[model samples]
Target chain A: MTNTEFIKSLSEKTGMTAEQLEPMVAQFIGAFARELASGRVVSVQGFGNFESREKAERKMYNPTTKSYKIIPKKVTLNFKMSATLKDKINS
Target chain B: MSDKVTLQSVAESFSRACGVPKKVAEQLARAFFDTVVDGLSNDESVKIDGLGTFRVVEVASRESINVTNGERIVIAGYKKVNFIPEDGLLVSNLVSDMPDVREDVVADDEETDVSNDTDETDIEETSEVDDETEDVSEDITTSEDEEPIDAVEAEVNMVEVPEKVEVQEDEFSGIDMLICTPESVEEIRLELEQARADAERKLIAAKEAHREVLRLEALLDKMEKSMVPECAEEEQTPETEAEPVPAMVAESVAKENLTIYEDIPSVAKEESAVETADEGQKAEEVAQTPVEPVEESLETVETPSVVETAEDENVTVNLEATTEEPSSEQEESTDVAPAEEDTKSAAEEAVQSTDAEVKQEDVTAEGAEENKDAQAEALNRLLSDKSAATPEPVRKKKDDGHYWIWILTPILVILIFGVSVVMYKAHSDKEKTELKQLPVEPKNHATPVKKQAPVVKPKVETDSIQSNTNVPAETTATEPAKSKAADNKSTAKPKTYILQRDETLTKVSRKFYGTKDSVRAIIRANKFKDPDNVPYGTEVILP
Candidate 1:
């Protein structure tokens, strides 16, 4: 299911308008983006952990060109399911 | 995990934004769904830029089954919405707390050491693999010591030696050579083990075959050892048996010769003079002599069947021989001529003896001769018709006795008497025929001659007996019955005729009767000894 589909499904379930639910979801997305960009963690309880990291410049292959290209050293987002969450998923 | 954000949960969160009632909010959500579906159907991209892009992607047509109707339907290439998450949203950290493993390679020409950072688990695995390989190599070396791998090792080297291996395929198999390296040490060990097993099996079979060969040789040796003594005994027995058989045959031949000599002394004497009769004489002398037990032992040595045939044939033949005539007559006739005086004396003696007991002895003698002739005929039938198997002259003497002497005695008597009667009738006829031919009348002498006939018969028989033994050259060359018949013919006549030169008895008779029809009668009337031999002017009787 997509984000809009998910939101629309929630609207049908609750007695709320799509406009009010839309702002709350946007605010949370914006906060998560800002904190991760500043090299901070957005730790959500009872869900999963997400973090940003940097990778060393390394050689990678572009399968379309079948040639080696340099993937530049850049920041990347990393998420790890917490032990409790991992246990819950496994269970 | 939190409650699943279904359409109901999301709509509750969205209801306050649209300021609509729950039912109106549900309608608005359905509208947004329709808008997304419509946009995708038009092949539009609904991009929520920071979150992700939802693009209408065309899926190529493929065959699929409609489960409800079980009908095959082709899902034509149609647009469907697909979402691609933003790069920032994709998690990059899957493994947590991974220690920094990179080594600093700041300067060139520096020895880099990352051993400290190497995984201990990987180290344990390498050591374990090395240990297993060492044990396996030890196993392979043991197998190599056990089996000579020359045949297969060359093939293995052939597979591995070439860097660019060119495989040679055999028509019989797809696998050329299984090249085992340190990487495949276990397989090499297993193959060596199999080879060792095959070698051991062959060795065992060869050993078994060798044992079988040894066993067969031993059996052959045993058989040869057993046969040696039996072969020696068999060889010796043939020699012993061969020696005795000839000795027995020689003894039988000598004994048989002795019997032959005893039967005829004249042959014994002549055989001595003419050939090797010394042996015959010795044999006869042996049988006749009472000095030695050689004859007795010979009798003992001869089988009972041989003795029976010899004694039976010998005694019966001699008894049937008409011993009235002495054996000297046979000997003298067969070989040397005895003196006339001796023959005359022998004949006189035989006649006197026959006359004294002729009637009784003749019957017995003829009866015995008949019996012997019957016996001889039986013997002839018993023998397959070989002239050699025929009994000797001594035996045949008995046969002539049956045909001529024994059978013809009574017949001759009856014939003589019947002739007298016929002669009486013939004389009557001759009177008429004679009267017709008679130039002179016949004197009546018939009754007077008839009165003299009985007396004349014996005297005539006596005369012939005397003449029979009275052979001018050899007195013993006599046929008794034949001579008697001739004498009877001569005695039956009254008149005589003189034969001219070269005349037969038939011619002599013809001179008296005018026709030769009376030739036989005339011949019968006179005892012209040989009818063909009427010597010139010889006296012939006319009946």
Candidate 2:
């Protein structure tokens, strides 16, 4: 399901208009991102956890050029599904 | 920000952002995730507009061995959820801000000259970690208050968010690792200890190598200094170019005596044989002339001294005399073949003896003195014989030789003296540069030692963090005292100042000493248990 389809279903279930739900969805995402940006694990009940993980810097060798390049450290968001959500999805 | 942001916190934030009722926002948050899960289960993927794509990837079954049992097994595969963040998100651009964060962390580490005590360092690390977390929380609150109203503003805020997050992550990278897995701290400590030990060993080896180079250079200087005098003595001997042959022969014989005295006896015997053969050849060539008997008697007299001295001067002098008398040139050419053969045999014997006996410097010196005496007697005999044979021609040739010698000797001496002075200047310059470098190397070594102190500080910081986590208030209280001691030390050595309201030891140290390390010394001097929290009007000494 794409974002529009998911939002349409959510608006229908909540009995809200797409216009009202669209802004609310944006607000929700903004809040979620803000929490994650603070280095907190955002845990949605029965869904999964969203956390930022650090990837250490590493050296990469280019065989063709015979030279080395340093890939700088990075912060990547990781998502691990809760066990209940995993069981629900698999079933 | 709390340690964990549950669904409730997200709803709370969402409600505050949209100015909606808390209950309605809570319901919306629940429904939002529920819809995402349902969408994933039905479509195997869910694409959120601003967030990212969530996909259920299929894993293929494969054969594998059980780790414990070491038996082959057909493993089952299942679906796994994967998240791919949108390209426009702040998290995707986190790497772009990493260099700045790294610079800040490195600068902080360099400025703080942490104590060697493991406990103190650990406490400092924990405090640093706490400070970083608080900074992140403060950033979050400020960002939320300045929440973006449109996509462009959100994008701008997104850029700001990641930069703050990156800084926090870099600042507490090691601390986070320690806190995440306690066991890895000890492992990291062991690795650090090994690295420190290796660095120290390498430093010692470098110092020893430097000393050896200096010693070798000094020996070369001594050898050069000794050679200058010998060159001066050679310059003092005023010989014409033709007579230089005899002077060269004398020098070579002196060198041979100095180097290989043990072979002198055999060399002398060979010299005697060569002289006899050369004289016989000369006598045969001179038989057609009236001077054959006189030349024959002169050769017989020269042969014994040639054997005793083992010097080439007699042969050279005879060759010079033959050259002056053109009739003997043909005889000299014929005599050269036998002379070469005899010298070759003597050289081979000398080489063999040299291999046998390599020592006895004192005996070589005595042999050189005796050889010099024999050379003087041989020279006197040759001069008397030449005078008796052709007195007028010998005197005329001597006058010409003395005039050339007088013209060339001073120029040669001056040139040689200038060369020696230049060489001495160069040697002295090199010694001066080396002396300067010797002092500088210790300072270079000292810098690395200071750097190593910071390296060891982190380990202790981790230790203190672990042990003092339960008594955070106490640690915080003690931290000020430590920083005050560092501050007082700086003041005692340098200047004095009154502490202002809201000013801490670190700020004062940075202002006065350009480093936060002096905070501990100031704290020690003031004897404050909590110097950072001290009264506003307290007087602090600066060093």
Question: Measured against the native two-chain assembly using Cα atoms, what DockQ does each of the candidate structures obtain, in the order listed?
Answer: 0.01, 0.23
The number of clashing residue pairs in each candidate reads 18, 31
Q: Grade the docking of candidate 1.
A: incorrect
lDDT of 1 by residue, B348-465 (tens): 3323323422332223223223323333232221111111111222122122222234345666899999999999999999898977766333323333223333457766465544
Top-scoring candidate (lDDT): 2
Over 4 Å off in model 2, which ranges? Answer: B92-543
Best candidate according to TM-score: 2
lDDT of 2 by residue, B1-543 (tens): 258889898788667655788999999998998888888888469998878899987778899999999999997776767888775354422334535644654443332212113223433443353344321222222222222123223333443344456445433433322221223345346534544554444344334334433443443344335444543542332111212222233234533331332343345445566654665465455333323333433333233222332224434554466445533333322333233233323433333434322222122222223322333333322323222222211121222322335445666898999999999999999999999989767656653323233456654344333323322223232342333333443322235567676778887776544478878988887888777587867788654
Global lDDT of model 2:
0.51
lDDT score for residue B182 of model 1: 35
